[model samples]
Target: VINTQRAELEALRKKESKYKKAQEKVSTNKLLKDEIEHLETELKTFEDKDVEIGSLKLQTEKLSRANKALMNDIKNEQKRYDFLESKYKELLVKYNIAAKDLEKKQ
Candidate 1:
């Protein structure tokens, strides 16, 4: 029974402490009111920017992913172009050889 009472007392004390802090948030000590209000305003401003920062981070990630995908596509297209160019060069060589053979027969 004593242990249970102690635990309850501790819980109430924690709750009271939280309430006191909340009360201070609503109204601080008069002597430090101006300074505290300024600090609170600055803190609130930074907290408000949290969403904007998150959105910017998400946008940056998306753009980076898109850039990577585009680079890969460009690399694949370059490889395809190289393959076709090599094939064309090979056909040109074959045609030149055939032409030489025809000239010799003539």
Candidate 2:
């Protein structure tokens, strides 16, 4: 009877040890799951920011193209003004020469 009681006590101790190990593993698994969830959330936030940055870059590129077109228009207008100014000077010189000839004839 004494040997039987000792055997039963040893078996119970072994079961208790296994249960403690299982509890520790469960808690460790829970901690790992929590960390994974946090990392996933952070990754999603970064992805959203990346998308926003891409949109801003596209807008910047569009603005840059528009500015280049405006600069070209300004350059064309300046060239046109220069051409008109030269023509006006040439006409004035011709008019002055004609005025002098008429005075001499008179």
Residues 15-104, model 2: lDDT tens digits: 999999999999999999999999999999999999999999999999999999999999999999999999999999999999999999
TM-score, one value per model: 0.56, 0.69
lDDT of 1: 0.94
Q: RMSD to native for every prediction?
A: 15.3, 3.0
| CA shift of 60, model 1, Å | 1.3
Q: Best by lDDT, which number?
A: 2
* Backbone clash numbers for all candidates listed: 0, 0
Q: What TM-score quantifies how close candidate 1 is to the native fold? A: 0.56
**Deviation from native of the Cα of residue 54 in model 2, angstroms:** 1.9
Q: In model 1, where is the ten-residue run with the lowest total lDDT? A: 24-33
Q: What local distance difference test score does each model get?
A: 0.94, 0.98
